[model samples]
Target: YFVGIIILPTVREMEGREGESEGGTSTATTIRRLEIEITEKRRVIKREQAQLQLLEQELEKARLQASKEAVIASQCVDEWGKPTQWDDTAHEVLKGVFKKKTFRLHQLEAIRAHLSGEDVFLVMPTGGGKSLCFQLPAVMPGHALTVVISPLLALMQDQVYQLDLVNVLAATLSSADDEYEKRRVFDHLRSMSNKGKQAPSPFLLYLTPEMVVKSKELLAALEAVYKAGNLSCIAIDEAHCVSTWGHEFRPDYRTVGQRVRSLFSSTPVICLTATATFDVIRDVASSMGLGQHRQGGGKKMATFRSAFDRPNLFFDVRYKPQSNKDQLNALLQTVQDCTEKFGSSCSGIIYCLSVKDVEGVAVHLREHDVQAVEYHAKMEVGARKRNFELWMKGHVRVVVATIAFGMGINKEDVRFVIHTTPARSISNYYQEAR
Candidate 1:
């Protein structure tokens, strides 16, 4: 009787423990289900946040477009898209597209003459908004196409990129482009020609002087647009390149004027340059065939010239160290000092005479833990482009490059520039420095 009593109690205790484990498993299953639901909710929240950001970006773009249209609607434009009057139309573009509150000296005057279908020769100091004179007209509605003939491919590329940022349609044709890029530009032109004035907006086409003078395919395409009366105006940037007396003369630039005259004689031509002497200006005017001004018969070319005075830039000359080690140390010191004074984002240019010098300086700076890049004609195309972009984006604080590298540099806040060799000419130096 005693043995039966002990065994019966032990069996009851075991049965009680099994009941508790079954209840514990039920609670764990519920907790696991709740965790899964929470994970799914988090995914939904993340996806919705991503969609919200995209919608916000689209809304911002639409807002800017609506504002631009409102400004354009208030201005008066002729059938050909030329401003019927100067002040309101030009000022609207200045504020709407360029985001400037007012016009600089002579900027409005130059635009007025060009938009009024007259030849314009504009000479403004660097950063004087010379480009705005022509660029603003090109963006006007129904303005058709404005052909920009530039001396360097770099300038063409830079301008095209900048115009795109402002929602302006701009394209470039050059040897630097691949076959697909060339075809795309040509196809866009053909499409624009087909639409005529009904085309969505005005287009700016940038080309090197050689492309205008030599490319038969481009010539044929441009001819089609010209015949349709869609070729509005032609702009020659850095026009001094056409003059043999100018500091940087290119023979191909000489033929570009002849091509323009033969094909688009009725189209108004606007030539712009930063620094040109009287002799250079006269040669540019004559060579560019500025109508009666060349033959002393028709309407005189409108001239807008500004003084070359930059009161903000200070110039100092320092003797280079005799030893290479000392030279590099001095350069490193200069860069470090500028960095200390201007902060890490300070951008600078160091001009060297030779490819070897550029490479050496860039490498030395890198070894010293400075973010530096080298650019020269001798570098591979992709490498040159990559290094240039790094400098442009401020990923690299300094660029050691050849003297030719600054022609199309669009950076506005460069803190310092160093020249390892003497400038080729005073005008050349001024152009590069400015």
Candidate 2:
């Protein structure tokens, strides 16, 4: 039997029909929810795309960095494979067997390379053992005669004296030496040459560029020696002077590169300088004809830079008062204080702005019981040398002068360097400080 059900519309059916009549409300709500979900998904995808772009950029940067590192590594490896050696005798000489304290490895290497027939440029600081670079190689086992072109007479004289102290056969070709002494040196060289043997001792001939240019006989003799393979190398000291744009421009240095190139084409050249900026170094190398191919086509020339810092030196700056007398008084007081503290054991130099100022201050110091002397171009060469000698010998504690006083002097124990007037540039200041 089947249960009979009444087919009648109730209250719930009536309510559902009323709701559906309101423009399909359930369908509109469902469509709106779907639109919101799609918008959120699109935002998430856009953020992910941005992150992917950033990752790609980082990857590209890493690749470029790797390529740069590879290039530098390859350059270093090439440098490492270059042929180089140290002269055993020179090493022993520098290793304190000769009573010389401290040895620079780069300086030794530069000398050895030059002796072994390679052009070199030693860019070292002042008092950085530059003399050893050439002096050591001069004594090497060869008929090698080293011709040194010094920028100043005093520097040449100092080198000769130092060599003499070491019992090395050294001579200076300057106008100051008497004719008899000059002839004696020339005859000695000639006798050695006639014997078909190296000179009794290594002969280091020191000459200025101007002297080298003017003396036809000297030039001929040097050229002959160079042709005979007796010339070992030509060292250009104070090589920065070769650059016309440098702070210390020497007109004589301009012709040095051309002369060396013409006369000593096969002989190695060593260019040395205490202070040279990056541009100065490049200009010096170019001026010396060592920009490209060096002697013997060996490894490329290297530059050894020592730090310019001098820990022993104290840096200070004092603003000058409006009154010149006040400034002078203040400077005098400082000099007096330094002298009283350091006594005869210390020496000092005071740099002035002008020649007149130099003279005035030096006179004032002399009058005030400060043993000071003046040095300027206006002074005779003899006077300058005397003043320098007096100061070096500790007879004078203070030297009140222009910038001309410090160049080529190796007074290492100078207690202080004062500039009554500020230096023209940082390079000038650093040179004086060194």
Candidate 3:
């Protein structure tokens, strides 16, 4: 009886424990099932979040595209798919921007051609109003921006300042600028590139061709503008640099025209060079995808050759003397005679063969009671620009410099140019002389 009793209780306890264990197993199984359900729900939420983000991006893009179209709608097009003659609003803008009431015949020609979306080659002399032709087109109703390529930083800055004075938005890129200025300009370009959300500002962005070809961000930005159809025109100032063997050849320049053409197939190009020969002109046109092309009923070239002859410029070549002192004396005599003919406070550039020669000439002149400054590539840019301005203001009577001194300079009262040696090419000579 005792054994039966002990065995029975043990068996009953075992049965009871087994029952409790089964209950605990059932609860754990339900917990695992709940955990799996929660995980699947989390995955679904994540996918929904990603999809929501994508939709937001698409919505933003559509909004941006709508704004761009609205701004473009403000512009009217002609039968040729070119911008029409701007309405009274354009006339008002032009009146405020230019100081003059009427355009020159060549200016009018360029303006009409530009509005017609025709590729053009403008060969106007230095100090002529060639800049105005390109500048006026940038102010038209449809153009979002104009990318002006120039080799000289000084020239870019001077042009930007002049543009600003006349109520056009202009900015230039240079390593010389501080961070704040660069950031501000980049922001402006970015917004300008974003399409119709903002009416395109009357902005002109100037950069070296190197910046366009080499800077990834800037190139992306420019490409974006063209892709958006905001590129009015590309005004290649000093466009002869596009040729490999041209004057002021920058290797970077030779590639920019082609790159721009490759990027913007439909965008028109206008190249202005004061001194390109027939061969150089051909090269530039080819690089820009513009040349003697067939339009309408007959074949015609887009090149517009302004007369190169300047009546005010008189040239005289004198052979160098054997003795160094005699050479210096002769040059001094020429300068003295020029001052006697013109006023004593006349402006001139004395071209030296090298930097050392420039320094020597300036020092010699200084020692002999001549007031002059030395300018060369070796000097700091700020100092060089200061000296150039001093000369422009007539504060200095002479500037002894290498060939580095005078491209895109706006001075017109220059009365004499004395060279230590003949330029390597006649084209170069005419350019320096004119």
Candidate 4:
């Protein structure tokens, strides 16, 4: 169908110059109008499809909750623990739950800090099992509610889905969730609240910072959890945003830091990010009230740092000094090399600096028969999510994206990550590429 549409230009449109057409109305202009109409219609279809998928997801979630509640009622689930020391049992539990036989050095360190009840500033490289750092501690036998403030809805969903698979009882509050979904999650929290030492399940509630600040109802619910003495830890993923460069994306992040402290004064808070400078490190600690600046000034802070090294990745700097055309050709050559190294089926993400650049690169790549999709902040949220899923599923080979494209994306086999324009900083580049 798309091929037919591409090849169906009117005779006058092909024969005439830029503006000339039959009846003094340019056929080219008519074609462009039709193309735009088709694009708008496609967007409508995608939106409807996304809504349908959301309904399906909500229904499936409800079913899962029903099944889980039944099991909880039928059996005695071990409530979470509060370990004073990192023990062999905890290690064995992690290995059993996650199907891993060993703990990475960084994982053990992060777990040790959590066991000690230290406010942590964890900076591990991307794909470095950082989620485990927070998640493992959540299952510790304790009356600790771990609230994870993630940066994006997609990220929250991904993390929750992973925990859900392990039967660890994670839930999220987000705009993407319908009322039914939200209510189910709230019910779980309410059941856990004021139960003294008995939590129905080990709960990890994920929220976007925007939701944290704007939702009065959510804030009230969090207060209930805290009042129940179940509020154990607050973790901020993509922790870079709270301090230095991330305020533009969500300024309310700072507000979240303040609110969490006010709500749970003694709760251990951890901020985990893969990107930050030496200076940004201290700033993050200060901004989140860690180290000597912790609320009461007596808490110890574990600033766990993992080396940001990828031995498998080879980094290079290429210069295209001639012209825009030359630079584009250089990019094509690199993409061609990747296509050869990996099969045509391999996927990649191409980073662009601006929305217009994303469009331009996507058009050019598509023209050259590279299955490319465009994603930027300017698009509707549903559209952006759809495009991301396309690339993730290999329906599209490349996503020409602006800076906000790849946060918390779990695709591990992205064969290439190309930065057509250098990001504002090296930190940003490492995050996208990683």
- Residue 57 shift from truth in candidate 2, angstroms: 22
Instruction: Put down candidate 3 lDDT per residue, 1-434, tens digits, no spaces.
Output: 45554435688899999999999999999999999999999999999999999999999987886565433322312222343465344456567777667655356666666666777777778777788877887886767788898877767866886787788888987665668888898888777777667568667888888888888888887778777778787888888889975876888898888887777767777888787766677788677667322233232335555556678777787777998888887777788878898887777878887898888888777777677898887888678778776776778888898767655666667788778877756766766667
List clashing residue pairs in candidate 2. none
Give the runs in model 1 whose Cα sits over 4 Å from its true position: 1-84, 195-197, 293-297
- Per-residue lDDT tens digits for candidate 1, residues 1-434, read 45554435578788898889988998999999999999999999999999999999999987886565434322312222444466687788888998889878777777877877778878877778888889998877658889999876556666776787788889888877779989999988787666435653688999989888889999999888877778888998888888898876788988897678667778889989887666676788788678552334486667667767899887778768999999989989988888897888889999888888899999999999999998887777668777877877779889898864866457776988888788788887887787
Pick the lDDT winner. 1
lDDT of each: 0.80, 0.73, 0.74, 0.75
Q: Candidate 2, residues 120-148: lDDT per residue as tens digits?
A: 77766778878787888787666357889
Query: In model 4, where do residues sit more than 4 Å from their true spots?
Result: 1-85, 164-167, 176-178, 194-198, 244-250, 291-297, 318-332, 363-369, 393-395
Ranking of candidates on TM-score, top first:
1, 2, 3, 4
Q: Write the number of the candidate with greater TM-score, choosing between 2 and 4.
A: 2
158 Cα displacement, candidate 2 (Å)? 3.2
Which stretch of 10 consecutive residues in model 4 shows the poorest summed lDDT? 73-82
Top model number, TM-score: 1
Q: Which of the two, 1 or 3, has more lDDT?
A: 1
Instruction: List the lowest-lDDT window of 10 residues for candidate 1.
Output: 72-81
